[model samples]
Each structure stands twice: as C-alpha cells, then as structure tokens.
Target chain A: MTPDPHRAHVPAVVHLDHVTRRFGDVVALDDVSLAVGPGELVGLLGPNGAGKSTLLSLVAGLRRPDAGTVRLLGGDPRDPRSRTGLGVTPQETGLPATLRVQEVVDFVGGHFPDPVPTPELLDQLGLGELARRQTGALSGGQKRRLAVALALVGRPRVLLLDEPTTGLDVGARQALWDAIREYHGAGGTVLLTSHYLEEVQALAERVVVVDRGAVRADDTLDAVLRRVSLRRVVLTAVEDLAGRPGVVRAEGAGDGTPARQTLYTPDADALVRDLVTTGVEFHDLEIRGASLEEAFAEMVAPEGAAR
Target chain B: MTAPTTAPTTPPATAPPLPAARLAWLHLRYQVLETVRVPIAVLGNLLFPALAMFFFVVPQREVAGDPVVATTAVAGLALFAVCSASLFTYGLGVAEDRQLPFDPFVRSLPVGAAPQLLARIGTGAAFAVLGVLPLVAIGAFLTEASVTLVRLVAGVGTLVLASVPFVLLGMAVGYSLSAKAALPVVQVLLFPLAFAGGLFLPPQLFPAWLDAVSQATPTRAARDLLVQALTGEPGSAWAWPVLTGWIALLAVLAVVAYRRDEGRRFR
Candidate 1:
C-alpha cells in the first residue's frame, strides 16, 4: 500500500509517477511523470529511440520501472488484475504463423470476460476477408490491422498502440484511424505513439513530446503546436519584405515575381502591428500556426542549436 | 483536466477470474492445436524412439521373445518417449516461443503465467503419451513383453511419476537455451542420458565405472524404477534419492533460467 498522491480524484487509467527506467547505463525514462484520465486520447510523439516504446511497455506491464510507480486502473501495472482493462498493440507484431486470423482474435479475446465476437471485430478492422487466412500468409498491412484488432477485441477501457500504422498505406491507415475513432467515440481511452506527426494531429487531443528519454513538452494538441511559437506569415507586397521587424526567415519574391513573399516570425501579431504602423502597403496577408512537423523539430531541436 | 466521470476511482474490475482448471483447459486446447496443425512437428518427437524400438528390439528373436528383456525394452523406450517429448516440447518449444513476436502479448495477459505453464506441461505429457503409442502397439503386436494387470497399471503410474524430473529438466533447458542452441543441446543430452541410464541397453552389460556413473543420471534412476514397476523386482536403493536430488536440482535451474529470461527481455 504505497501512498497514492494520484488517488484523490477520478483515478488515472494510466499513471506514471516520477518513473525512471534504465537499460544498464542508459536511462530510457528519466524521472518522468504522466497521467491519462479516463477517455483521454494522448499521443506520445518522439523520434526513434526516444523511449516512446519503453514507456508504453511499462504501462502494458511487460516491463517494470527501475524507479517510481506505474499504476494502471488504480493497481500496480505488474498485477494481472490491473491489466484486465488494458489492451496493447506494439509497433511490431508477430502472429503465430499457422493460426488463422479469427483464431488469433479468439485466443486473445478469451482472456477478457466481455470479448467482442471474432467476426464482428474482424469486420470492424476490415480483416473480415482475411479471417480464415493464416496470419503467416497475410500481407504486412493486414497483419498490422489484425494486431490492432487483437488489441480491440477485449473491449478494454484503455488502448496502448505503438506506431499503429507504421507501414500502412493511406487507405489502410485511414481505415485504422476510423476504427480507433470509433472505439474512442464509445468512451475508450487511447495512448498511442507515432513518428508520424500527421497521425498525432489527426487523432490526439493531448500531446506529450518526448526526446532523449525525457518529456520536453506535454500539453494539448493546439498548445504543443503553438508551443513552438513560430508563425508563418504570407503576404503579397509590391516591395520586398524579407527583413521586416520580427521576421526569422522569409521567402521574398524570386526574380520572376515581386508581389508574393512568405515570412516566418516568432510574433505574428507584433509583426503585423509593426507592418501597419510602418505603413507597408501589403495585401493578401495571411498568418498560420506552425505545423506539427516544424513544431516537433523546433521543440526537440539539437542542443546548442538556434531555436 | 476536468474529471471524465464521477465513477469510483477504483480499478475497473474484470469479471472474477476464470476457474483455474478451465483456464488451463483453454490454454491446453490451443497449445495442442498449435502443435497438431503442423503434423511434421509431432513427427520430430515420435519418430526416433519408434524407430529405435523397430531396429534394435524388434528384429532379434531372443531379445523379443524373452518377456523380461522385451518388457524392459518396452519400459526403456517408453521412458525415452517421455524424455524426448518433454525435452523437445519445453526445450525447443519454449525457446522458439520466446523469440516470437506474439510472446510479449501472451505474457501480458491477465490469466497470469500459471495456466499457460501448466498447459505446456500438460501438452508435453499428452504428446509423450502419443509418442509411446507406436512403441506400445509394436510391443503388443510384434513382441512378447508380458505383465499382470496390476503391474501394467502400476507401470503406467510409475512412468508418470518418473517423468516429472525429466519434465522439469526439460523446462530448464527450454528456458535457458535459445532456439538455435536448443536443438543440438537436446540431441547431445538426449542420447547420452538415454545410453548412460541403460535405456538403450541394460546396465548389467556396462563396465563397472560406466555403471557407477550411470547410477548418477536421472534417466538411469528412471529406468531402474520403471523396470521394477513393469516386473516385480526391487530397483536400486539409490532410485528414490537420485530422482529426488535431480528434481531439486532441475527445479532450481528451471526457476533461475525463467527469471534470467525475464530479466534479459523486460527488466
């Protein structure tokens, strides 16, 4: 009965408190702390080897932390009772080579009391046609889909998906996203990791950006995007405007076109105010938030490098 | 963040855990199914001992005609079947399973490892029974090995008892070795233990030093006990001690191997 500071309110479906995990001399999670309330879809965004999978492994109860506590459903993650409501789809899945897709689902589902029907779950993941096929015979995308289907068959309250759509095509990735949304819409919580920023932008409500085995930024999706604080301002001007106040970089008119220019700045509002005060004749003015791509790069930018 | 619900903060309870026997049965069903679907997998264990019974015991009239010799041969090969199945099932099977991508998924289940580990032993026992079937059929039809009804029943029970140490020893091998090393290790251990234990030939035919050394092996102890069960004779005074000692030894090794594997993979 360790003291639970997190037990005061609605308990987190997944909670990690100052958790530090190590592999020999390397720290995979460095005194990290996170909590996901019930029904929250949080995306773990990081570069490869950023400890995203390691963190998920701790939550999934496949590994234990070197320090601190991890609670799943209010019990220690290592306990079987605590994991009953947890489902996980790892980045790489290995299915029994000879087992049929339906059978694999059935085997995993049987661990839970209220398992989804085999055929029904398969249909949801678009693996209905491959239900009878041996998992070894499946295409990479199909196997990945089946792996997600295995995670969902248990109807767990929380799903931990690591790189769920790594190798999927656009169509398959979309189908998988729809299935995930459908599950979430039904009141399930999801904590997923991805190298694909669009994947996070499309599905995550909250984002935790991890780098070098540490949490660099954790906030809502918009906040994480806004946290980079880089704005792209595009305007059509008769005169070049590359070196205006607050502009970090700009794509001024090329030799062939002088009327269009794009400028990037940290303070779009101040830049705009400066523009109007300076009486720069500008039309077609537009300001946009940093895309997650640029946001991630800037947030986890190399040490000692300019922001 | 706003609380998602006013529901109790307690962990979501699953339906009370399933009965242990039923869970074990579920695991056993798939374990057996996984093996049988690949028919060649079964043959790997059943083939060698049946072939031994065919080539070594069947063609010799004197060896086959004498009830004592023939019955001892039957018992020896029967033990071989158990050891073979136990070793390959745990040694090769468990090792290969650890390398599979599905392994972590299964290990993460709420059913815990008990049901699955029990089911593995159960599957090994079931297949061991099958491994003996060909030899048993050959003994009944092609040889003159004979016994009373009571001894026959006792022999079956004794075989089950004697198989325990070997099963535990197999698990040690299974948990400790990688799949690649398991095959050659099983082979290297299997034949020597079988030979030194008087499983392939009687200990009475061995040199004194070899005979003394054979007395130390778990397989030799098993053979002595099984032969005594099939025929109303006293096994060596060392039989129970040998079996008990090996069981304790192999149990420790198996446990250590299991923990080491967990440490390597997940710690």
Candidate 2:
C-alpha cells in the first residue's frame, strides 16, 4: 500500500490519546495522554527509570504499547508514513564508533527520502571539520552533537530527543537550544526528555513531569512550579543578631567577622528590616525565589526524591 | 588562543524532493557495505577458502596421479567454499546488525521486512561470487575434467544453490547466538560438515553407516552434484534430489528462526 502523500502539511504532529505500556509487572507508562502541535517544543522531564525512554520508543515505533493508541500525524506508530514523519535522538549515542563522522551521518540520511544536505547538516552542528574523523575519535561532547545532527538530518516533522544535552558543555548546550528554537521557528514540533530543569525552562513552552510511571504535573513551566508551591528567597544579613526566629540557618558573619549572612525565610523584607534596625548594616542584599530544580524536587519527593 | 565560531547557515528555504527509490537503494547499499567492512571477515570468507584448497586439495593432487579423485576433491572444496562464505560472512553480520539500533531505523523506513531480507541474501550472493570465482578459474585451467562452458555454468549454479542451506543455517546461527559466540560456533560446524560431506575424503572410503549419514548432509549432496557435473560421472544422481530437499528444509528453518527473533525484537 502507498503512504498518504499529503501528511507533510498536517499541523498536529504527535497525539498520544491514551497510551499505556507495561514491562511484565512494571508499568512503564500509565494512561499517558499528550499532544504536540506544530511549532511546539514540549519537554518530557523525569529522573532515570521514570519511563521517559520507553515513552519515546512507543512514539518512535521501537516498541509496541500494551494498551491504548499512539498516533503520529494521523497514523499508527508502526506505519511507514508515521515513522518517516518522526526523527529520534536516543540517549545512548547509537552511531557506529568505527565509521567516519560524515559516513555515519550519510548512512542514516540514506534511510530517509529528501534528507538535509550533508554540508548543511555539518555546518549547522559545527561538525564541518570533523567530517573525516572517526566517531571513536570524537570527544564525549562531540559524540552527543553528532547524535543530535543525525536526528535533524531527516528534517522530520516531529523530533523526539532523549537527553540531547547529556554530555555537552555550556556553549554546546546553548547552540543546541538555538538550533531547536530554529526548528520550532520553522514550524517543526519537538518532544524532548532532559534531566536539566534549567534547559527545560529555557527551551520548552510546555512541560510534563512523570513520576512513578504517571504524569505528576503537566502544564506550563510557570504553572507547574506554582502548583507545587515551592519557593526560595536568599537574603544578605545586615545585623549581627546571635539568635533569630523563623530563620532556618544563617551563614557568613555570626561572630562579627566581615562577611554577609544569608538567611532562608518565607518572609524576606521583614527579617532584613528588623536586622537593620537592630544595629545591622547590609550591602548588595538580594532575594531569590524558587528555581525549577527546587520546585521539581518538591513535586516528586514523595517518590523517594529524584537523584 | 580562543577558537573562532562560525555562524550557522541553514539550507535555503526550499530544496527539491528526493525520490523514494533513491532512499531504499541507498539503504541497501549501506547495509551491504557495512556487512563486509571487517578485514577478518574478508580474509576468512575469501582468503581462507583459497588457502585451504591450495594446502589440502592441490598438494594431494600433485602427489596422486588419479584425475578422477583430484576432480572430486575440487568439487567437494567448492561446496565447502560456498558454505563457509555464506554461513560465516552473512550469518555473523546479521547477528551484529541485530545488536545495533538498525532494526528501529529499518522499521521506521518505507522498506518492509521482505526487501531487507532480500538485500541480505543479495549480499550473501555477492560474497559467494568473491569466494567461488578463483576456484572455478583454477579448476578449469589446472585440472583434467569436464570443463565445458555449459558444465562450468552449471557447476557455479549448483554451488550458488548449495548456499541456500548455508544462508538459512546462517539466519539460525545468527539469531540463536550472540556475536562473540557466533564465530566459534561457525568454526566448530564448518569442519564437521565439510568432513561429513566428503570434502576431505571420497565417500567410497567411508563405512556403510557413515556413507548413509553423508548422503543426508546438504554439503555432501551438493558436492556430489558438483562432482558429477565436473567429472562427467552420472553415478551419483541420487545426491541431486537429496540436496534439493535439504535446501528446502534449511530454508524453512531459516525463516522460522528469523521470524521468531524479529517478533521478539518487536515485542
């Protein structure tokens, strides 16, 4: 049978209506339902063994689900058309280590019709000079870049990236974020799994937090953090008060040496002003709120905390 | 000094479409290229057989004056050569491919399982060509036998057909064993099958039960056909039907093993 010729124009790229997967007694995915529309970059964030990889495999047609349905661009997971519409970057760098970088990319490119040109892909990922180098010769960060490049070469409508920045440096990580933004800007959809909460906050407009094989929180980054009500505020101490109420711990100048004391409190301005009135002087005082890391930690802490 | 970074350039907004056939053709070519990329496999599949023929079969012929026995020896070696190249090269290659993530990509592509299997068989047939060509040339030039063009063509055809059991045997071996154990398993089976099939000695020297057991061997049946075609001896006609049956049997085994393993991968 021939594939549908008009799938390239569809807007909603991936729709997992109610997909559930079980490995023997363990439920890898529990009645998970999600949708990724065109021009969207959704982050699937969870700790190890939280079934992030299994979810991607189901969408990529690597493994079948035990119950429910997963539809990619209006076709079943195993459909040839569905597969062609999607590209995947697995956590493990899956390239043949012995092959030249160019050859490995070329080989994977051969699997898809109308793949991006080799030079274009090389230049985009800054791998132009390493084309002739064997994959085994690449550094850990370079290997991860090649893995990302392999997935992008297909110009797929929906991209599934599992820990795309696992071993990358800061610059490399931002460059990947820019590339992902560019893809999204051009109307491609992406579903990524990452342990870096900062990365998810920076790149993904929507996030899904799965814990114990179920969706613990699924909403915008701001919304989920708000749902968990986890907050943090750092204060620069102005007073040398030996004892204080409502302060968890104070660091920096309890003995009156010349260092700033940081106090953790739910109330920020009240404690700072009280210390100032009681013969405390302060400079460069700053208050910080809860980070995504703290919020996520609180959300999944009941499942024995995310390592 | 700091490294200078270049600005990223995207492909122009529009490029032409790539036809579907081009993709499938490239996949097949890449698969075959990677299958034979190893130097050890190349030497084992091509060089080892030629070396065995030179040391074991050719030297004996130089000492013995009987042309008939030498011709039978060449026929048996040809059969063993086909088995070695197909079972060793194609079998182990499939096992290695299974360990890779290639199956996910293969399933993702527009190509079906049938086309992939056909590509593997084509690769096996290519290795067969590399392993068998030298023997055919040397046997025709150095030996006294029925080396007519028709007979030579038929001999090559029988040798290629004899690869069925080997290819099927490879699929089973490839599926049942890990990559590390595959080569050793192939090594243990190769000599036994070759010896039982009369590649090392003529079937006449064996006892009655051994001869009957040899008659059941696919290599023995195939070697007999090659010997009959080469030496103009029509006495071993029973070997033809028996070899064809073994070919069919091995083909069934290959398909079963492949399907079972493939199902496991999907499940």
Candidate 3:
C-alpha cells in the first residue's frame, strides 16, 4: 500500500524503488519506496533509528541498498556526476576544526560549477561576522548554522537536511525554518527529516511518517492531521466525570472540590451538550483540535487508533 | 508541500565540475592551511630529527668530522626524517581526522576521493620536507657533511622517492585502525624500522647476518639508497629491488585498506 504510486511518472529528482538495507542481521530499511518531485518540500517524520537517516544515505550515495535501485537526478547516486547538483546537511556537523568559516564555505563551494558567493551566503545564515573565526571556536549552534550554510553554498538544485534542527532552541529553529522557506521559495527541492512532529507540522506541505523501517502514513499535511478525530476537552468541575457521554478516556486531578479534568473524545460538540444538559457546572472549559502528537501515535500504532 | 508557484523543473544535466587537478590543488591549499595552523603538530615532525642530529651526530667526532661518514649519516637521518614524517603524518594524522565528522563529509563530496587524497599526500610531503629542514641545517652547520650540488639535488630527489612506500604503509595503518590504536602501532613500527635500517647505527656496525636482514627491509634499503645518492658510492645491489618490492606490496595494501574502509563506512 504505497502512497503516490504514480510518483515515478513525474520524473522525480530523487527516487527509491523497493529499497532494502540491513546492517548485519538488523534491518535498517525494509522494502521502502518513495520519491521527491522537483521543488517539493517533503518532511520525513520518524523517531530515532526509524531508518530516516538510512534513507538519506541511500539517496546521497554514501551507502548502497542491499536491494532495489535509487536514482538522483535521473543518474545513479553513486556516480559523482549525479551528485553535482545536490547539497546535503547531515545530522552531525563536521567542519574542519582549524579552517576558518569563510574558508570552509569557499572550499565546499569550489567543487561546484556555479556557487553562491561566500559573503552573501554567510550573511544569509547569520554567519557573516564569524567568517574569519575558526570553526572549532564556534559554539554548537553556530557550527550547525555553518553546516547549513555549507549545504547552500553550492547552489544545488536539491537539499537533503537530516534532523536539521533537532537540538536547536526555538529561536534558532525558527530562523533555520525561515532559511529553508526562502530556499523553497526559490524552487529548491527539499527533503528534510525530523523526529519532532511539530517540525513537520510547521513546515512540511506533505508529511511522511516513518516508523520501524517502513512507511506508516504519507499524505498531505491536512489529510494526515484530518485522520485525528480525538479532540481534547479540559474543564474544572466538582463532580467526577470519568465516564461522561462521548468521552473515550478521562483523567482527573487528585480528589478535590472544583478539580481540574481533561477528557478526550471523538465529538467535543456532543460532549459539551451532554455536560450542559446533565447539569454539570464546569468552569474554564477549553476545547482544542486533536494534536499531531496523537495523530502520529495512531499512525505508528494502528490498532490503538481513535478513529 | 506548498504547491510550486513556478513550474516544477528537473535539474539540468549536471554542469562540468571544477577541473580535477584544480580541485586537487585547492584541496592541498586548505589541507596545508589546516596543518600550518597547528604549530605543535608540525613541530613534532621538525624537532625530533633535529634533536637527534644535534645530540647524537654533532657530538660524535668520528661520525660528524669525516666527510663521507658525516654525509651518509646526514642522508640516513634525512631519510629517517622523511620516513618518520610520512608515518606519523599519514598514520596518526589520518586516524585523527577520521575521528572528526568532517572527514566523511569530505569523502561524500562530488569531486571524489582522488583530489582530497592527492591533496593529503601533498600536505604530508610539504610537512615532511619541513621536518627535514632543521636536520639539514644542524648537519650542515654543526658537522662536516659535504656534497656536490648535483649530489645534493639527487639526495633530495632520492629522499622523496624513499618516502613513497612508507607513506603507503602509513595510509594502510591509518585506514585500518582507529586513532588510539594507530599511534602506538606507528610508533612501534617507526622506531624499529629506523634502527634496523641502520639509520641511527652505521651499517658497518651491524653484524653480517643482521646487515643482510636489514637490507631486505624498506627502511634499510631506503637508507642505503640515500647514502649512495649523497656519497656517490654504490650500496648493496639489493637497494632498488628491495625498495621497489616494498613499494609494490604496500601500494596494494594501501589500496586494499582504502577500499575496505570505504566499504565498512558506507556499504
């Protein structure tokens, strides 16, 4: 049951067909297939060791799959020629320790036929001031920013960013997202992976949730979120309401008058109606749509799906 | 994904990458920059041979006062300098870089490993030559080693040629072992090779049986050739064959080690 089965017809910049990869007896990727069409910003959402990095390695030609073929820009990924237009920021940042920031940028850019000018690229990534500083002297966040800048320096047609902002603070993460958005704005194809569901929810037009080395759900962001029907209802009330109508699960604060409670249900509308009609006096009632957290959980653990 | 506003376009046929030689030169330039910034690392290669020359050769009148003896000793130590520099520079230097995340990213670049690898060789050679300068200065200034201009140039060329097999050997070790293990291995190999090759002790001092055995080793063969280049006297006929044999053998081992490393990391 593959999503976008006709994806091959569109001439994908990156395409993997039934690829399987293993380490010793451990299967890293199992019969997985996917494609990224030109100019699409696809988010690969998965938890740690879900084979997200493994998939990128296959496309980047750093590793070969035990089965099936992978193509980059219509050429075999292993061929250096095929990778000329691709830029990648792997999960770990590794700039030469003694090389200055600008030198690192210049060195990487030199490999490409048409590269972004060093000064402009550094300034865009907020690294202009650090150009003369050695990479080893930079803070962790600064090194990460430089890594992303190196990925962009080559003016590549495709960018593959693995866990691009996993450990970044909110502000840093947002800034990187904006940089990615700018690239997307210019029609650069991006295939980024993240374990943070909110990261996918924030930037991805399409979400591909990967778990246990297989595709769990691959669809438009709205469509994936729509699968989540369990709305959250929070209120403070005097009565016990664990088994209220339309509520599938409920938790309450330790026994107290006017205790706080949260109810999860399929229909907040009917639940609110039942609460009012039943003469339950509750204050501070709040209703919100189902979170991507629960939606992702359902996708990964199908039998427990609320819908 | 936000549906594209402009039409989706496939990447054009890839442009011709930077010329391979130019890329290799650029790689060498940065590699040199990286090494130059670390003064101590370069100093290690330079100081050891110079210290040996100063303490052992300069103080010994019989070895340093006689022209032929002094010149051969200088040549042998120069070869030792090249050998030591090649081993540690490639063996430990490569192993250390392997520990860094940057090494793999460089390996993944589209220009392929040739440019980077060639540049590493150039960097190692540059520093190996730098390592020799102090020893040369100490021998020239403090001792009576003398050579014609032709022989002087020949000795330099021979020293570079003699470094090849050791560089290959270092690469094999570098690729095959982690940094922690590689350091001890390179040290253990370096000291013994230098001693057995008669680089420290004169070949004539070696017992006949030991001298024969020494001639078979790359280090001894390299030392003998270096001595011949400087003294204009021929060494045992085994020099070229022994050196050539080690070069061929280590060359294969180096290639095997490189491929094995690639397979282990990427496959």
Candidate 4:
C-alpha cells in the first residue's frame, strides 16, 4: 500500500500542488508539483536523493503533504472508493518471503473488485512455473517480475512502481519493458521512477527530471533532449581547421594517428562539409545525436557539474 | 421434477450485497489462522505451563495446601498465554508489517483501518485461548485437580481479562522495536514477568523483596486473580482492584503507542 494520500484519482489523477515533506531539518520533498492524466505513462527520472520515492509516496496517498493538497480522482485519498482505482508496488520488497507466488497474488487480488485470475497473471509474467515456489527462493529478477504481476492483478486505473527493476539483469530488464508496453497497450496509466537512464528513454513518453526535491524539467523526451547539444561525433581527420558554424569546440589529432576530432556542434551537416574541404581523409565518420542520458545529466547537474 | 409455472419470484430473491460485517469477520478469521500457525507460539502457550506443572507441582504430593496446587497451575498457564500472544507473537508480527511497503498497498485497498485493528486484537485473544485450553485439560485429567464448572468459567474469564494488558503491551512493543529486535525483548520480558508474578513459583517461596516486586507486576495481579477464582480463596482485599488497574493501565499504554506509531511520522 502507498504511504501517500495524494495519488488516488482519475482525470488529473494525481495532484501534488506545492507539497513539502520535511524529515526534521532535512526536507525530502520541497514544494513539488506534478500531475498525470488518465492513461499517460510518465517516467520520473533522477539520481539518488532526488526525491523520486518521496514524490511517488505523495501521489500514492500514503503520506499527507505538509503544505499542499493532493486530490486523487477528485476525492480525498483516504476515501475507500478512491483507493479501489489505485495500485502500488513500492521499492521495498513487500511480499512475504515465506509465501508462495500464487498465495501472494491471490491475497492481493482478493482486495479488488474484478482482479485478474492468479494463474493467468502468473502466466502472463512468465512465472507460472514458479507459482508454487516460495518467494525467498526467487532470484532478484524473478522477484521483480513477481512484483510487477502483483501490481497488475488489481486491474488498477493508476499504477505506481518505485525502482521496479533495481536489481534486474539485462535480459530481465527488457522482459519487464515488454510487460510495461503491454500494460500501456491496455490504456492503463503508469507512474514510475528508475535510475536506469536507458530504461526511462525506452519506456517513458514524457520525462520529469527532479533534482534537490524540485522539478527541473517536465517535457517530452525529445523536447528535453533539444534543450542541450551534447552530441558525440567521431570523425577521422575531422578537422585541423576550426571555423565551422554550429560547432562549439573541436579537438583532435592534428598531427597524425588517424586524425580524429570530437566536435561539440549543433549542426552535423555543415561540420561534415568542413571536414571534407579540409582534405583530411575520414575513415570512420558518424554523427551521434544527444541521448536522454546527457539531457538528464545536464538538467540535474549541480553548480559543480555533478551527476 | 414438477415443471410448475411459478410466478417470477423476483429473480429468486437476489442475494443481498455482501455485508461489511462479513468482510470484517473474514478478515479476523484469516488473521487468527495466520497467528496460530506459528509453531513456537503454540508450543509455548500449550506445553510451557504443562511442563511447569509436571516439574514443579507433580513431584510434591503434600504441600501447605494441596488445593493451592490447582490455583498455581491455572495461574502459570494463564501467564504463558499472555507471554505467547501479547508479547511474543504480537510484537514480532507488527515489526514484519512495518518493514513492508504494505502501507501503500493496504492504504489503497477498500478495507477500513478499523477492521485491520479489530482483526489484530481478535487474533491475539484467540491465540491466548488456544494456549489456555490444553493446560486446563491437563490439570483436570492428570493432576486430578478438581474445578467446578462455574470456577473453571470464572478462571477462563480472568485469564482472558488478564491478557488485555499484555496484548496492549505487545502492541506498544511491536511499534517501538523493529522485528529483529522485538523477539529478544519479548523473551527477556517474559521470564522476569512470569517469575515475578509468582505464576511458576509461589510468592512465599521467593525472597522477601522479590515477593514485594511480585505484588506490583501485572503477572502477579493476574495470577492472584486466577488463583482466587480457581481456589475460591481470597488473599488480599486489594487483589481484584490491583488486577483491574493493571489491565486498564496496560490498555491505555497500548492504544496510545499504537495510535502514535500508526501516524506514520517515523516512516
């Protein structure tokens, strides 16, 4: 169950307006405001201590925000009806380790109106074989898979997952991605926070960058990436000549040794032409666009440029 | 089968909506089963007092009052129930729940907090009862300690009432300590309380100062109440009042601690 009361709603489903949560002198969430629509899958991205978990708790209706009102589905979070529409899988391992997979699924399913059948849910997550096995016997990846299945059994209108894949292997991570895609395909809204930049880029359509308990950027992945021009361009010879339009800085082996230079440029075509004119026989020439990772890093970077 | 053309009996009297009362009952039932399934709790509740009676009272055929033997056994078993349910099981279980992210899961469920609280209290009481029954049977059959129906019922009532304070105390302990730490604290408290209360050994057998300490312990008051109820003998005029006071004090402390812990300030 979520420890926050602000996260139980429908249209404008989750509202955290000027919410501030302080633990003694240290403020965990400082006047944070964010919202999710009925069927939007929003990815919350931040580094450690970025208030990602705190924000999720605020929306999940667990913790009461100190300075703000969080209305979920047009009702108070403590309202029983409002809770019926919400499902949460917190970062902490919530399942009883002694219980078998099927038992946990059944237990959680019993709380909802029309839950997915336990066997069917297990089969969907590729966990049918492990249904009778104790949760303690599962690997980290398997436990995560089971957690995802637990969240979905409720047929919830809004789903909250906190670091859903914190300890998953590469293959298991993609498996979870497929599951998330299927969930969105069914028009279910999802709110998630993850440290995995690639996972965020691949799964979330809209990204919200939080740092020091505040939203630094709330935009689409493309829009946020356009905010900064940190592209990696690998070129042979590249340039001894520097005057290229849109090129901020260029450095390379002007002497010899494959003559490669990295160009920090917004324009790739013009730089390529300048390289051609310089008559520095380019071998491996490729222009890489700015990834979400760099955009996220730039957004959350402190005054000292720390990620 | 008579194919009688019956009037449309209003869709065969559609079943009434599942009552909230039924949900509460089912939740309590589930909690009871889960609590009772713990083997150590069950063993301590049933076997501990039986063992105490076998070792302590059974060997001494003639004591100051052979009838006091039955009172001693009932008091021992009653205290055992309290230690198992209120201190050991309740404290450990609450710690486990706190560690889970269940606050979010359950907070989002349609279940009321009242039902959860009710289920916990009910489970603790039920486990205490299970612990007391075996000792009652053992005293009757093996020791040949005779207790009338009314006396037995009164003893059972006293045992249950005596457990209220312990249950509340257990709740406070549960909220105060993490699961790993709660178990050891429960064990440490159990022996001193059981011994101090004069449940296993009589107060006369203890040192003069220890007997004074026994008079203040909840276990002592509870034991006195059970002993009076069983033997039909009153020790002191203050016994009943002191026992009742202990129950009230423990109840207040338990609820206050629970309300504070449930506020989620620490989390």
lDDT of 1 by residue, B1-267 (tens): 011221122244543555667778888989988998899878866777788888999999998999999999999989988887788778887888888867777766677655766687778777777777788778878899888889887887777777777777777887787788888999898899999999888999999999999999999998998899888778899998998899789877876676456423433
Candidate 1 positional error at B18, Å: 2.4
Q: Could you list the iRMS of every candidate?
A: 6.4, 6.8, 5.0, 12.4
Q: Which ranges in model 3 have alpha carbons more than 4 Å from their true place?
A: A1-5, A90-93, A228-291, A301-307, B1-11, B205-213, B262-267
Please provide TM-scores computed only on chain A for all of the candidate models, following their numbering.
0.80, 0.75, 0.79, 0.76
Residue B265 Cα positional deviation in candidate 3, in Å, after optimal superposition: 6.2
Tens digit of per-residue lDDT, candidate 1, span A201-248: 899988898988888878888876666668989899876777787886
Q: Interface root mean square deviation for model 3, in Å?
A: 5.0
Q: Single out the weakest 10-residue window by summed lDDT for candidate 2 chain B.
A: B1-10
Clashes within 3 Å, all models in order: 0, 2, 2, 19
TM-scores, in order shown?
Answer: 0.83, 0.75, 0.84, 0.75
Q: Model 2, which residues run further than 4 Å from truth?
A: A1-12, A24-26, A90-92, A232-291, A301-307, B1-24, B35-37, B62-65, B101-108, B137-146, B180-198, B201-217, B228-267
Q: Write the per-residue lDDT of candidate 2 for residues B14-105, one digit (tens) a residue.
A: 12334455654665676666655666665666676667666776666562336677667667777777887777765776777667764554
User: Which digits, one per residue and each the tens of the lDDT, describe model 4 over residues B136-165?
Assistant: 776666664777899888888887777777
Docking class of 4: incorrect
lDDT: worst 10-residue window of model 3 chain A: A298-307
**Residue-by-residue lDDT tens digits, candidate 3, A1-307:** 1246466466888888999998888788889988888778899988788899889878887777889899988888776788787888733456777889999989988887777778888887788899999888998788878888878777777888888887888898888898888788788888999988788878888888788889887888777666555788889998878778877667674365888887877789999999999898899999987676764565576343434
Candidate with maximal lDDT: 3
- Model 2 has a DockQ score of 0.18
